[model samples]
Target: MNNPNALASQSFDLAAQQHPHLLRSASYNYPHRCAFKAVDDGDTQTVNQRLSISPLAIWLNLPARRFDTALGRDFLDSLIAEITLRKEAFGRRPVTQLLLRHPFLHYQGADITELMHLLASNFRLNHRDNSPIEYCAELLLEEAEGANLALLKGLGFNEFLLSLPASPSRGDYEKLHAIWQHAREFAADSLGVRLPYGYPEQDLHSMRALLDQILSLKPDRILLTPASELDRWNLQDHIHEHGSNSASQFALIYNALRHAGYRVLGNDCFVIGRDSLAIAQNQNRLRRTAIAYNSVNAADLLGLGPAASSQLGSRYESNLEAIQPYIENLQLHKLAIDKVLQLGTKAKACRVVADQLLCYHRLDIHYIENRYELALASLAENISWEFNAEANMELMRIHNGLLQLSDDGIMRLLFISDTFLAGLLKTPKKD
Candidate 1:
């Protein structure tokens, strides 16, 4: 199991089932598409996958959980240098961006404000001050203990996003207001925050309050559903006797955001007229792109530190969870990648189709069958299973090589993830 190659295989077969949410969220789909697992392992096959590929940029490391000025600067400089080298090696222009992952120490023993200050200094000193091309950075504020939206300016990241906690509450709505207020001040390019479920019919005010607050943020792009800790199926049966209560919840937020002038980009992500994503979608530029904001496209992420995950063109990999293994492997001049999944042609195509459905709730069956030689019949059948007796709905249809969901189903998108799995298995369960 320690063998990196074998671990990669196991990760695909084992971790994927257990960690379906990796694929559930439009943003987190990168790791799920690669191969998934929660273990200490590595992969060795297609070892040459790296040298043959071209990347937009090489990432710099994040500061430690607790900030150390010198180390963070060194990390930034090293990343910049690597970016230069990668650009040179590929014989491309000096147009490479740097990706910085949040160390996310939470409020346990660190202040995000200070971390922001440190990162801002590093960017000014290393990225913007010295570089000729407009060097940009994307901060995955996916995990942070507090919300000081002002801190983001110093970090110098063009794109900023977060995975809001799944437990939706009044305070959480207030937090969204603060985040949006700051996001507007800095024009925090696109924003994403999780919205948890379980709001009762009578407690509609809370849902309205939360959704309306998020609408007020007026973000250009929004990744709304980031995969809650609890799956819809796991909720009480009565809550979703009509299959799932997810659609109702999703509809609430969806309508509010739309009323506020936002339109759906794909499935779960939303964008207004001004955002670049909307521009691209208008120009017909959204073709096989990643769900991320500033990294090297979803497929080519370079996770530099422990707990970072990557999905390169042909390989899916992750770093060791412990710092020691990552450092030791680096010292030995070897890839610290402990988990890997060798992506084959069909899997890659399926990942794309899956992403399309997850994001847009539809797929080009014609394209898949014709291009990748994969069958949509199974996908179709799986979708059909969704509306079966268990879901308590007579909805869902597959026709003309396209997957379509009714207005009712759209509201239930949050809960359909399990249905997606059931459909994929070709056996829709009642539960």
Candidate 2:
């Protein structure tokens, strides 16, 4: 219950006072070491931690035990209300397509639509909502005649997923089947499904079987992700747990997509032919965001909620996660920011280059040069040497300032490690 505003600063002071060099980016605050119960996985801890996410995504995630809590619900209401009241300040939509923690909601005595509407508090989602923009390709395209055309996509104009229950019951699957059977009629502009890993009795056969069931829906795209969003979540292991290498696992998914006549899109996203994303990729115009591929720049993101993040200009900031602190700050009309990292020139330059590698899998050295006067020799003597220590040395190289990743290097940056990326980002020199 300390001032959430200073929590990030205090933690920074503590880390600097102790072990500053072990860290890399000062702006990238590690959540575990922040204001909450870092050591425990209790309800408050998780809620406090997760509530740090944007309100849309937070509601998607139901708390572990408490299905209903007056304070939590009220807090969530306030969060949305505040966002709704202030549009000019943030310049983000209140009715954005919220990421629902699908598998967590209970429907014993609740209407999913009503519950979703209540939670969102800012948008309208009907069975027939028709979005103005296309969403994720993971969904099977809708070709029905005026069926459910009122279900519009929300603020984040991405795919709408029926987050499968973590522990699905007969009823769950039945409900899911009913929805999927007529999902196309939902008038969804674009639809996608997120298939999560880490299920009971996980094996290749089970994976394939579950995948088969999902693919049978013919979603526009199939995005495979980890059920648990842990920082150390091993997606490769989830794909083929039999001690498979990254290359082998990559081939597994790549080949599977080919077998299904589906094209392997960037990251883990797979797309059917003629999908908008595929077209965008074909034209080299697609840009990836947390919500999936879009034309919006990732650097322009402004997050809200406890520990919600915002990356504006050359600075990054995140709110404090504790509910009391967040609510208190909002009541005081102050941004619930606990940490801020103002990026230096080199950091920004490196970020642009790194983001290219991350999102596009290639570096536009010319773009970096036009933006900043970064020298090729400085890049080699300093940046190159620094990265080589952390990244795969064999894949590390800086040829005339046009940094390119080998297939192995791209795989490393894309699939497994951010070690090379971390070294590229400059840490703040403590005063």
Candidate 3:
């Protein structure tokens, strides 16, 4: 067999050179093309839009700046208003998961603990049904040390997710290990680690070493992300020139992890075989954003705080990333929506197919035929023919009434998804 790592590297370089967008599907926002718009408070139709589907998860993105009591309360009030509106519209199906991102950076000691309590209390009172909710917090490794873990656990934040540096020092690993032990003591339900690859210093060797260190602690799930061109996490001097070969390097790390018995799914997420993400993938219920979730049925996402985005049914809405505007709009009893995309029939179908291939690694022909009312047999035939060509690398194949992707195909999911999207776009819309 051809060396898997070599195949990944070759395919990755070609993807970068010719199919850059396809390679970019590895990023969280996969098929979404955001079109921003100014918020008009007078637009009642837009402002009054509510969640059409019961949200499975609620994401609270804390501002990077320190938290203020008055401002924080206003934010919470705005969140409550939004939830109330969704409940009124969709009826309370109850959100099963709540993820609070960058919480520790915003507050400390009693203040942070108090904020968590308030958030947990308000969310429970407003959104709870018979199902018990899972409360999760995503924060930096450094912040984990000083965070009031005991209080957070009491507030029902059972899951803790931390992002480590691209190149962690010995001290960093030690600190993480210490935090891991403490989290277990607090009865933390699950701990996930997000590790970024493609930094100037990271190669296959370095990444494997890093994986060894992290695996020793045995995080419930591991996410490997490409280092952003801009240092979003404030990693200081570790930020350097990110080369164009980062994707190729990421592919190498991915192949290495797979050979080591790690179940690396989608593009960059690695987990044990029994991890929820893996199970969700097998069950064909994995949904993706910045995080992955199991959506047994249709699932919506409600995002709060500055710069957040929500996927509510066929519509995608984003809040103003600017703190002042987000705060002022909410203060005026307005949803701080800065952009909206109402998915058309074609776009929605494209997303469904893309999600199936990217997350589940297979596309059910009958499922698409039944759901979209579009004949994909012709599309499948075309894909098979073209994929058989040398240039296309045969990344995908047709099995018994199913179109399944090889690992290489998953790496180029956006490309394959785009191909299907092109076919959908060509089809005449039903009158």
TM-score of each: 0.60, 0.60, 0.79
- For model 2, residues 1-431, the per-residue Cα lDDT tens digits are 23322333343344333332221111122212121221212234224323332312222322222334435455555465455543433322322233333212222213334444543454332223443333221221221112321322322324555444334445555555666655565545455665554443344555555566666777777665544242234534433442233233334544565578775444456677777656666676655433344432222344556556654444455678666787887777765668766556656655555456544556665566556654323323344344445454654465655665554454344321233233223222221
After TM-score superposition, the amount by which residue 97's alpha carbon in candidate 3 deviates from its true location, in angstroms, is 1.5
Instruction: Evaluate model 3: give its lDDT.
Output: 0.63
Could you tell me which 10 consecutive residues in candidate 2 have the lowest summed lDDT? Answer: 23-32
Q: Which scores higher on lDDT, 1 or 2?
A: 1
Off by over 4 Å in 3: 1-18, 21-27, 34-55, 64-91, 117-133, 201-205, 229-243, 289-291, 295-298, 391-394, 427-431
RMSD of each: 9.3, 11.0, 6.6
Model 2 clash count equals 28
TM-score, cand. 3 vs. native: 0.79
**Where is model 1 more than 4 Å wrong at Cα?**
1-99, 103-156, 162-207, 225-251, 265-267, 282-284, 287-299, 378-382, 385-396, 411-431
